[model samples]
Target: MPKKVPIRKCVGCQERKEKRELIRIVRSPEGEFSVDPTGKKPGRGAYICPKLECLEKAIKNKGLERSFKTAVDDELKELLRQKVTSYEK
Candidate 1:
């Protein structure tokens, strides 16, 4: 039997995709947010596709803020942008 693949929805595109195909953004208990490439980090997580358009959409629609349930400052948003852009390289 083939292994069942985990599925997650992208906050940006609202599309269902395999977990491995999305980047995970995790918010620690201490309220620190970071990208989790391994998808094993503790705390709340939000998934987004590895594309700039998705990232922009997520930002514009406040998807991350809704997922994290906290205000995301501009600095953090810029940091996330950097991380997402790095993944494109």
Candidate 2:
């Protein structure tokens, strides 16, 4: 039997898509934010599409903040933008 694929919602576009098709942003137990390419990192994770528009939408809509349940400051947001921009296709 085929393995069941996981599903994740993009914090950016708010779209429900297969987990593999999205990029994951993980907040480690130490409260560190980083991108999880493998999608298996053990921590709170938020997903976003591989698109710049979605990134902007997420920032503007406070989607990431809601997902992480914390205030995402300007520096962190800038850092996230840099990391996510590289992942954009």
Candidate 3:
């Protein structure tokens, strides 16, 4: 029998994809937000594609904010941008 791969939806593209193919954005219990490369972080998580366009679309559409149930400030948005850019490299 083959193992089934986990799937998650990209907040930006609104497309279902393999979990490993997506980047995780986590909101800690303390209300801190960061990109989780391992996808094992404990907190509220939102998945997104690794592309910059997806990141931009997520930001523009307030997808992260909606997922985290908090207002995503500019600082956090910038940090997410940096993380996504670094991941793209």
Local accuracy of candidate 2 as per-residue lDDT tens digits, 28-81: 889988888887899999998888888899999999999999877787778777
lDDT for each residue of candidate 1 in 2-81, tens digit (9 for 90 to 100) = 99999999999999999999999999999988889899999999999988999899999999999999988888788878
The lDDT of each candidate is 0.92, 0.86, 0.92
Off by over 4 Å in 1: none
Candidate 3 lDDT (Cα, 0 to 1): 0.92
User: Cα RMSD (Å) between model 2 and the true structure?
Assistant: 1.5
Compute the lDDT for candidate 2: 0.86
TM-scores, each model vs. reference: 0.94, 0.87, 0.93
Cα error of candidate 1 at position 18, Å: 0.6
